[model samples]
Target chain A: MFDVSRVQKELTECNRDKAISGVSIALYEGGSDLSHLRGTITGPVSTPYEGGTFLIDIQLPSGYPFEPPKMQFITKVWHPNISSQNGAICLDILKDQWSPALTLKTALVSLQALLSAPEPDDPQDAVVAKQYLQEYPTFVATARYWTEAFARTSVAIEEKVRRLVEMGFPEDLVKSTLDSVNGDENLALEKLCSS
Target chain B: MAPVPASVARQAELLKQDGNTYFKKERLGAAIDAYTEAITLCPDVAVYWTNRALCYMRRKEWNKVEEDCKKALQLDSHSVKAHYMLGHALLERQDYAGGIKELEKALDLGRGANPASYMVEDIWQVLAKAKYLEWEDLSSKHIYRMHKLMEACERALTSFYTIEDSQVQNDCEEIASERLQQLEFLKDVFGKAEQDDQPKEVPDYLCCQITLDIFRDPVITPSGITYERAVILDHLRKVGKFDPVTREPLEQHQLVPNLAIKEAVQAFLDKHGWAYKMS
Candidate 1:
């Protein structure tokens, strides 16, 4: 019952502005299953989350585009509105305020906005909120450190291919395997070894 | 010009036979090699290119299949296999409307040749799929066009049943039936999509959350969530036994027809019938 064509259209529209909007969506594992997706959103500039690339896990329910997409942060980030423990977000647009007119791109843009302006009053992580309100400088430092430590270490494609090739697999196989696993070196190596 | 040597032609024939053997054995890679050799010996022969295209199709290398099929068609414009292969490749590449045109040509050409050589049912099914996929995006805006397309699919199904080939007929029955059901569903959905053009705004509560349409036979879930009866029932049947909006555990029996809201929607529709075009 999921509107696959609508999701496909949203992906095209979102990715067209990836360089400008800093949000991109791709099918999980390059498979045609539209139910599960991997989305990447570059952190907003001039914010604690800047220079970090956040990955979001997007699941389209059967009533998608009608029912709001179920999205959760896959990357660890320290923010008042986002849970450090599980990456659950306390955002209004993602909840009861979601409208049918909004797209995945708009949702991601809202998240980027949320990254820039953290609301301490309605917080997913109470500890983070308390720190944000009581010790503003410490909260900024912690958030920046968390972004640097967790979100900035995405594996480069060339580096992954090189590592896999060094492990005695053919370059073509390494490249293809890396692509299939979305550039995960360990998974690519496992696939290569299995093959 | 001098006549071609008999030995060279015989060598090409021998290679072609070898390719046929490999093709029959399902050794597509070996078959392609043999067909390539046959083409190298006699590039003028369209059959060799068509045979190689068949091997590429088996390998699921659609680009290569399209290229070879194109080459075969250039050599012999009337080759049914080349047209069919090219059409299939085009369809796989998501050129549905273009593929349908090519397939129609293939079917027309096939009819004049050997009846047994043609898989008419398969062609019809692919044609149905191509037609359906082509019209899918437009169905919401053009209900009349969708109705016409459904009629065309019905005609194709009828014509397919007229074919005497039992083997192909049986092979295609499931696909044909499924396509018919799909077209019917689209027709129903798009029929409602016509209401989208309505200028008047119904009250917020009258609209079904699942359909976004003003309620027709509105039903209230046990959780107090109201939905169009058919829409909620369909969601419950196909998706899950949970409220689409509330996600509360629900059952069909838990749904009670909300007569008050239904009357309200009816009164609104009656006053502003032009808005809904209440069919």
Candidate 2:
């Protein structure tokens, strides 16, 4: 059986240090099973991807840490190493380089690292890699534009929590309810009233 | 304590042995009689009283166990058996504070005598249960008191309609608001206490780097890297026969049980009873 306790510990530990690390993991669909998780990594500073928050979809296999967790980007990004059409990454750690010692936090951190240092030679998206190599300035402009359009100005999770808390529900209860509904404020407000 | 004659001491020792045999056979009545006779001959020795108290414990006579254990402690204050039995007796009688105090004392002495003894492990497990029970008892009482206070406030507000004086009514409204404020403060305190349910972090060395969990059966490989036995064995079988960290050639035969880390983990778990929920 998969080590649920270890994954639970990882989630708690990762979230506890998220403000500093700029990466966090939560249950996917707020389901009780530890198998599916959603990860968030803030864009690294001093990169074209700066000021963006990217979401990753994580699914654990039955073997879990013994086998690497399946991770994919949920947010669109223009990068050589990450698919622009679909958010599959070209990182070795996700495949052959995977070790049981590596945690979900480390994998997400590596994704953040990949954002800062994109490997154009070993590319997931040939078109983005070609743009990055042959026309560097245009590639930078497109990446920054993609980051601003897709990653920024879309996280309304905290806003929903604040609104619900202003409606006089406890902040913890409101935030958790918001999470359970995939951050849909209207559904969360409905849940709060009935609960 | 007065020294008994050598002949009487030898006879008491023989009687104590007979009592031990009866105890091993689960013959509590015969064991109690033998221990009583031993205590009569050797009243200065604490073992005789503690042995008789053990028989009382087996009989589920908690009061008798408490009495004899106290007598044993009077003869020899540092006897681990006497303190442990007294603690168990007090716990059975619902005296959590007294039970926990005696258990702690027994733990201290037992550790000083032999850290790895079975009695030391037993003492800590009982202590953890006692502490958890104490917490549950105290918290439930607190909750009941809060509920009662809330009910009283509601009742007082309902009765305010019977008063006719406008001034009295204003004063009553003010008191009711103040009571409501106090209730809000109490609710905040309870919320914080509920959040405090999260456990403290385990030490890094005690956890397996591979599994990121407290080690159950830790083994050190030839490369001097320690990993949990099952995880490492699985790695060798499924992944490759090498240490995940060092990438060194390793096999199951090269792994040895890491007794020191195992003992350290056991000691840590013994001390933090709340952590039992995690592992």
* TM-score leader: 2
Error of 1 at A147 (Å): 1.4
* Candidate 1 lDDT, B202-270, residue by residue in tens: 566876755455564577888888876655666677656777666778898888868788678757754
Q: In every candidate, how many clashes are there?
A: 0, 0
Query: What is the C-alpha lDDT profile of model 2 across B1-279, one tens digit per residue?
Result: 678999999999999999999999999999999999998898878888998998998888999999999998988999999999899999998888899899888976765243233375467668767876665555567667766776676566556533634535455677667767866776676566544443577788988987787665578988888897767877888777778878888877898878899789878765544454433
lDDT of each residue in A1-195, candidate 1, tens digit only: 776645766787689879999999998757788899988899899999889989888888887765678889988899999999988999987877665446788888899899999999999999999999999999999999988876775525677677777878889988887667655667777788888
Candidate 2, A116-161: lDDT as tens digits: 9999999999999999999999999999999887786337567767
Q: What overall lDDT, based on C-alpha atoms, would model 2 receive against the true structure?
A: 0.82
Off by over 4 Å in 2: A156-195, B1-199
i-RMSD per candidate, Å: 7.2, 1.4
Residue A72 displacement (Å), model 1: 0.5
Q: At residue B172, what lDDT does model 1 achieve?
A: 68
- In the order shown, the candidates' DockQ scores are 0.03, 0.36
Top DockQ hit: 2
Worst 10 residues of 1 chain A by lDDT: A149-158
Query: Distance (Å) between predicted and true CA of B58, model 2?
Result: 28
* Cand 2, B chain, TM: 0.59
Model 2 DockQ (Cα-based): 0.36
TM-score of chain A of each: 0.82, 0.81
